[model samples]
Target chain A: MQLKILYFGMIAEITKCSHEILAVETKCNSNQLETVLKKKYQQLQSISFKLVINQNIATKTIFLHPDHEVALLPPFAGG
Target chain B: MHKKKTVFIEGAITPDFIANSIAKHQTKKSIGAHNIFLGQVRADEIEGKTVQAIEYSAYEYMAELQFHTIRENAFEKFDLTCMHIYHSMGVVKTGEVCLFVFVSAPHRKIVFEAIEYIVEMIKKEVPIFGKEVFEDETHQWKMNTV
Candidate 1:
């Protein structure tokens, strides 16, 4: 299955792309995706971000559902 | 259900607009206290360059959802009469108001706490982005370190 990923704030700056669709195999959890992302984009390792599934923040150990809107959210600076 | 409230404004929020908002509330006899929090764009000196302005952006749909949720939670936890939140979109110059949070209640205590909590939650949860543009025309993305 494929999951659509979004990058925001400082994470988008490091990744140099805002959004993309990444293909991941079935039964692969969120941890595997994080590792793959860090490996693919080495700059991502330097930044801290949250993984949001369907607009809700999730932990690294959480499972990824293909139907959800997945995104990488950097720390917010809003008031 | 209440109508959808606007949380975003084009470009920057003006001091005059904020003053007008405060003026509009002057006649409310039930409001014993009105607490407000305004976020101003800072001119930060980073890497020997000074920031000139900040460009703001957000995932609007998600931001609206988050704002509504915040409103609901605040209303539940506090005895507020009304609340309003306004944030700028696009370019906002240094020293300009980027965000305005207003809370009114019958008394002073709850308004203060509610305003603080709402501002804190917005900073932690909203999908807003800021790009710091320097005087030299160079720019860098801004993020919360906490």
Candidate 2:
């Protein structure tokens, strides 16, 4: 499965890309994806962020799907 | 149930634009009360420097999804006739509007509650970020603890 991931705010600065497509197994969940990303980019391990799957914020157990728009987002500061 | 909304992840929301939006809603005879919440960029002295603007960013897709969900939830929880929410994306200068939430209902009570709920949800659930820019161009990220 090819998942498109978006990085926002400071996360984008750290990741150095706004969005990217990664090929992973269809059975991979949010946690698995996070682990894979952390292994690739070690700085991700120190930041607090949320995983949004298909435009919705999801828990670590949320399953991945092909073409899902996933975002690695940091905490909100909007008033 | 209201018409599809206008959602923008822009630089700053202007006062004239907001006034125009309010004027456009004048035809709604059923709405008696409207409550609006405007979030402004504050100039504060932090670390011996003054803040100039806020560079805003968001998880665009997820922010829209959360905003839609917040809209639906507000309609379910309150008797609102209409609602509007807009937030800034890039550099919003100090004293400029960054976020605006407007809600209308037949009475004052529901409008008040709906607007508050909408703003709260946007603050807590949406994946928006603010980077505070100083006069010297140095920046510090804003973190919301709650």
Best by lDDT: 1
lDDT of 1 by residue, B88-146 (tens): 99899999899999999999999989998999989988889888999988898888654
Candidate that scores best on TM-score: 1
Candidate 2 residue-wise lDDT, B27-143, digit = tens: 999989999999999998997999999998876666777788888888899988888899888889999999999888889987877887888888898888999999999888787
Candidate 1 wrong stretches, greater than 4 Å = B1-3
- Of candidate 2 chain A, the 10-residue stretch with the lowest lDDT total is A51-60
Per-residue lDDT value at B51 in model 2: 94
Give me the displacement of residue B31 in model 1, in angstroms.
1.6
Against the reference, the lDDT scores of all candidates come to: 0.86, 0.85
Instruction: Give the DockQ (C-alpha) for candidate 1.
Output: 0.60
DockQ winner? 2
Distance from true location, Cα of B145 in model 2, Å: 3.4
TM-score, cand. 1 vs. native:
0.91
